[model samples]
Target: MATDTTTFKHVSYLWDEAKAAELAGDEVALLIYRSNLLGADLRLTNYGGGNTSCKATAKDPLTGEDTEVMWVKGSGGDLGTLKRSGLAALYVDKLRSLKNVYRGLEHEDEMVELFNHCIYDLNSKAPSIDTPLHGFLPFKHIDHLHPDAAIAIAAAKDGKKITEELFGGTIGWVPWQKPGFELGLMLKQCLDENPGIRGIMLGSHGLFTWGDTAYESYLNTLEVIEKCAEYIEQNLGKKGPVFGGEKIQSLPKEERLSKAASLAPVLRGFCSSNVKMIGHFTDDDRVLQYINSNDLERLAPLGTSCPDHFLRTKISPLVLNLGTDENLDDVAAVKEKIAPLFADYRKMYEEYYSTCKHPNSPAIRDANPVIIIYPGVGMFAFAKDKQTARVAAEFYTNAINVMRGAEAISEYTSLPRQEAFNIEYWLLEEAKLQRMPKPKPLSGRIALITGSGGGIGKAIAKKFAAEGACVIINDINQERIEATTEEFQEAFGKDSTAAVTLNVTDAPSIEAALANTALAFGGVDIIVNNAGISISKSITEHSIEEWDRLYDILVKGQFMVSKEAVKIMRKQDIGGDIINIVSKNSIVAGPNNAGYGSAKAAQAHLSRLLSAELGGDKIRVNTVNPDAVISDSNIWAGGWAEGRAKAYGITVAELPAYYAKRTLMNEIILPDDIANACFVFVSGLLNKSTGNILNVDGGVAQAFVR
Candidate 1:
C-alpha cells in the first residue's frame, strides 16, 4: 500500500532502498551510521528527549582483552549533538551474563554498580539508565523514541486491536510496560513470538525497532511510526481546542496581576523567558460538562502520559469547579482541596509500589505531579522554569492523546504498577545522576592575557588567579619574562599559572601559545585579549611601521586569540568567554593617538561580532574600555610619563592627578578597576549579557554628570 503523505512530511525517514543498500556493507562505518541514525530517530521522537545505543568491540581494561561492549549515550546529552564520548562503553558479555543470572540479584545497587563499572574512564561522562536495555538488545543497532501520534492511538480504548490492524502481523505489540528489566523481558518474549517482526510497538509507551545496521533500524522506526500517525489522523480527526478556565472578572486587579506574575515565573523558569501565561481551565463549561459526564473518571488516569513525564509535569491536573469563588485569596483553599487528592494519589502509588516492587527494591520517590490543572483557573505545569514547563506540557499532551486513543482501542492498559516502580526506582537510572563540575569562575579554565607581565595584564592575571583561573601570561617583554613568571608563581601559587613570552603580533606565536595553554589546562574556557601598546602620534605623524605594530597587537592579536579560542571551545563543547581590554581612547578618540584608537575600535567591534556568532554556543564575548590609570611603574618604562608630561606641559608627578581629574567621578581608575570588569564578564552573573562594551572609566564615557 502507498503510505499516506500527511504524517510522512512531519516524520524524518530514510528511503528503504538507500537504508537496505547501506546495511549491506562494512561494519565499522555502518556502526557509526547507525549511531547517527539512532540520534536522528531520537531527535524525531519527542523532539530530542530520548537517546539510543549499540554494541561494539573495544579493548578491555582489566584483562587487556579485546571484548564486545555496549556503548550507550550519556546522561544530559541532546541526541542531535551526541559524540563518541557521549556513549559510555559497557562490557557486553558482562551485561548479557547479568541478564541470565538465576539467583535473584540486588537489582538496584548491583545495576548501579554495573553502570558505574562501564565508566572505565573517570574523565568520560556517565551512561544513561537505559544502557542495560541497549546492552540486552541482540541486534547491533537499537532505536527508541516516544512518537506522539503512535502513543496517542495506543492510549485509546481497543488500542491493542487498532495497533494490530495498523501494523499488521509484521509488528509485535506489547501492552504498556514500564521501561527496564520487565519491559525488556516482555519485549524479549514478543521477539521470540514473532521472529521476523521488524519492530515492537508498546501500548501507551513508545516504539522500538532494531536492525543489524543502524540505518535499517532507524528507517524501520520511521516507517512504523509514520504508519501509526497516518492511521490516527485518518481515523481520530484533529484534537479539539484546549479549554481555558472561566474568566475571573471578580478577581482584584492587583491580585490578578500577582497571580499572573506567579504563573509567569513558573513558565519562565521552564522556558527561560517571563512572557505570556497560557492557562487552560478545567472548570470551563465544556470541560465541566466533560468532567460531570459519566466518562470523566474513565478518561482521567492518576497521572501523566508516562511515568518519566512525572518528573516534568505533575501526576494529574487539578479539576476546578465554577461553584467556588475564583479569588487569589482563595488560592490557599484550592491548594487545600488539592492536598487530599494528592494524598489519595500517593496512597495509590504506595499500593502500586507494594504490589510491584521486589522485597529488596529501593525507596519510592515522592509523588508530586509536575502539572496541576485547575477547573476554572486554568492549568499550571510546575517545573524549574518555563522551558521545563513547556517540555512537560508537550509530554503530557502527547500522553493524554495516547491514553485517550488507547482507551478507545482497548481498556487503557499501562505497564503494571510494579514494573513502573522498577523502572522509576531503577538503580541504573539513578546512577546517571552525577554532580556537574562546579564552574571555576576563573581557575583551570584557560585564559589568554594579551599584555601579560605588564601593568593591567599582570594585575588581571593576579586577580584571575586569586579567583581560581589558570593564567596564560603573554608579553612582548623578553626581559621581564623570568621576573613576571616568578611574580605569577608567588601570587597564584606554584603551578597555578604559567607565563608565555610571545609577541601577540605574531600569528604563529599566538597559535603556539593557545596550543600550550590547552595542553596545560585540558581546554580553553576564557580569553583576555588585554595586550595593546599605545603610541602618541597624530594621524599625520603616525608611521606605517608604528601603525602596523599598534594594529598588529591591539587589533590583529585580539582577532587571532579569539579565532583560536573559538576553535578550542567548539571542540570542547564548553562555551568560552572572551574579554577584550580596549581603552577609553578607542571610545573618546584622544588626539595624536588615532592609530591606537583605531586599532582598539576594531578590536571592540570584533568582540561584538564574536559575541553574536558564539552566543548560540553560550560563549560570551565583551570588551572593557578603561580611562587612563597612571602608575609610576607603567609610566617610567614605556615613555608614557614623559610623553604625557610633554603633552600637558607638566611634570611627570602631576600626570596622575591630570588623568584622574578627567573622570566625572574624579576617582583614580586603577588596573584593578579594569580587572574587576574582566571578573564580572567571566563569571556567570552576566551569562546573558554579551557583545556590548563595559566602560570601566568611572562613568567617564556616559556623557553625564556623575
Candidate 2:
C-alpha cells in the first residue's frame, strides 16, 4: 500500500505507548487510537471518506450504572488525526433497540435522523452513516475503508469471485446494497454465516474488517488490502491496453509551464459564469506519463474507480487537448473551441443523467468540469480559490495513478455513469457546499502585489489576502518572496498566495512573471504597482543614467505591468482594479527631488490617462500619494533616508515625526495607511470614483487632490 504507484501511502505506524497503556481497555481510547491509525493514511481513505467505530462503556447520568455505548466517527470528521471528541458515543441498547421499533428502514435520511437522536451523551456529536453497521456487529472493534486497490477489486464485475480467490475464504463477500439499516442487517447476516471470517468485502463499495481488539481489526485491514494489492500487480502487470488511444508526448516542463500559464486563465474565464475560479497547474512525472499515454482519452472517460471520487472529480474530465500542438493565444479562438466542447459536455452529462439517474437522485448540479486536461501542455483544475483547485488537482493526480494501475492489471474499469451521478448529487456533498461560510468580499479574486518582498508592498499583499483575494507576491528577491509566500500560505491557507520573480524594467521578465501570476491564480484581477525607488538629487546634478534609470522603473516599469494586466482583464471581461503607488512629491515639488519627484509625477498622470482609456473596458485606475510611509519600506534603503534627514537638519529617527508634523492632520502615516487606501479602490467602495489621487500623508494640504 506504500508503493510509489499507490496514491494512498502510509508513512509510518506511530502510536503513543503511554496513552495506549493509560486507557488500554477503554473502548473510546482504543477506537481513537485505531481510527487515527487508519485516518492518517490518504491511500486508505481520503479526507473523511471512511469511518471507524467500537463498543464502549459509559456511566448513565440518571441510572448511575455502567451502560454499553457505541463510539463511532462523527459526521464531517476526518479519520486521519481524528481526536476523541470527533467520535460520538451512543447507548448500544438504545441503538440496537431501534431495530425492533423500526424494522426494514427504507430511506437513508430517516436512518440518519434516528442515529442523530439516539446519542447517549447530550454533549456528544452526531453519528456517522455507518454507525449501525458497526453497532450491529458483535465484534469489539470494526474498521471500514474505500481503499483504491480494494475498491478496484470490489467494484469489478466479478469482484466476489476475485475476493474469494484473493482471500481464500478468509473474507466474506456481500452484494451491493444502499448503505442504511438494511446494509447493517446484511453485514450482520454475513458475519453470522461465516463465524471464522476476518473481514467482508462490500461488492462495488469497500472493505470491512473486525476483531475482538483494535489491533486485531487494524492488522486485518492491512493484511487483507496487501493481499489484494499483490493480486493486482501479478495479474495486471502483463495486460495490454484495455482502452485504445493515440500516444501523445507532453511538452517538456519549461514548455508546459509557459503554455499552461497562458491558457489557464483563459480556461478559468471559459469555465466561470457567475464567480471566477482560480486555476492550478501540475505536470508531475506521473501525471505527465498518464496524460502523455495513448489511452488517456479512452481511459479518462470510463468513470472513477470508486463512486465517492465523483463528488469531487465529476463523471469525466473536461478534455481541452485541441488534439494538436498549435498555440492557443487568441482569446476569441480559444473561447470558440471551448464553447462548443463545453456545450457538448453539458449535453452529454444531462443525457447521462436522464438515461442513468435513479428516481430518488438529487437535481442536476453544475455541469462545469472540475478537472481540465489539456494535451501537450498539462492539466488545469479550477475552483473558487487556489486551495480548492489544488485539492481537486491532487485528487485527480492520485486518481490518474489509480486508474493506470487498474488499466495495467486489466482493462481499466470504473463505476457505471449512473453510480457517479448518484454520489455526486447526493445530499452529503450538496450539504458541504451549502454549509460553507459566506465568502469575504474579495473571495475568488486574485491580486498581484509588485515588489512585495518587503515594506509597503508586502503590507498591501497582506491586506489583500486578508480580504480573501489570493495574493501573488512578485519581487526581484527570490529568498524574500519564498519566505513571504510561505507566511501567507500558513496564515491564509493553501493556494492563498503565490510568488514570482519580476524585473519591471525588463519586458521579457515582466511578461514571464505575469504569465506565472496567471498560472498560480487564474489571472491578476487587482494589480498594485508598488515597486519604486527614490534618488534625491537636483535636476542639474542628476546624471543622464541616474535620471533614465529612475524614470525607467517608476514610470516605464509601472506602464509595462499595467499594460499586461489590462490585456488579461479585457480578455476576461471581468473588470479589474489598479492602484499605482506614487508619492505626495507628485502633488507638490520637493527640493533636490527632481529625479524621484518627476518620475512619480509622470506615472501619476499616466494613471489618469489609463483610467480614461480603460474605463470603457471596465478597468479602474487610481493613484495614491503618500508623503511618508517608511515602516519596513525599502524605498529609503539606498541612503535616501539619511540624505532626506540631513535636508531637514535632523536625525533619521526624527524624519517620520518631521513629515507627520508638517501634514495638516499631524498624523504619522504608516504602511497600513497606504494599504487601506488601495483596499478601498480594490473593494469597489467607490465605483464612480477613478482617475483620482488619494493622499495617505496624514491630510497634506499642499498635496490635496483639488
Which candidate achieves the best TM-score against the true structure? 2
The superposed Cα distance between candidate 2 and the true structure at residue 212, in angstroms, equals 3.5
Cα deviation at 645, candidate 1, in Å, is 15
lDDT of each: 0.61, 0.78
Q: Write the per-residue lDDT of candidate 2 for residues 585-624, one digit (tens) a residue.
A: 9878778788888899899999999999999877889998
What's the residue-level lDDT of 647 in candidate 1? 62
| Model 1: ten consecutive residues of lowest lDDT | 272-281
Write one digit per residue (lDDT tens) for candidate 1, span 1-706.
3444334654765444576566655444454455455456432454335657666666777789888866666666756556666666667776666655523333434454556654544555576656665666688777766776666655555666776787677878888755555556677788888888877777666777777766656666767777776665555424432211123332343443334333322221222122212121112233333333344444555454555554445435444343324443343454455456656655766676677776656676544445554332334454332234455655665555555445433445554444555656655554443354543555334566777777888788778877766677777776676687788887766556666767777777876676555433334567888776777765787789988988887888888878876765654444668888887666664556677778877887888888889998778888888777665235235565676577677888887788778777788888888888899888668878888687877667542212
Model 2 weakest lDDT span, ten residues long: 1-10
lDDT measured at residue 48 in model 2 versus the true structure, 0 to 100: 61
Question: Clashes in each model (backbone N, CA, C under 3 Å)?
Answer: 53, 5
The global Cα lDDT (0 to 1) of model 1 is 0.61
Error at 30, model 1, angstroms: 5.4
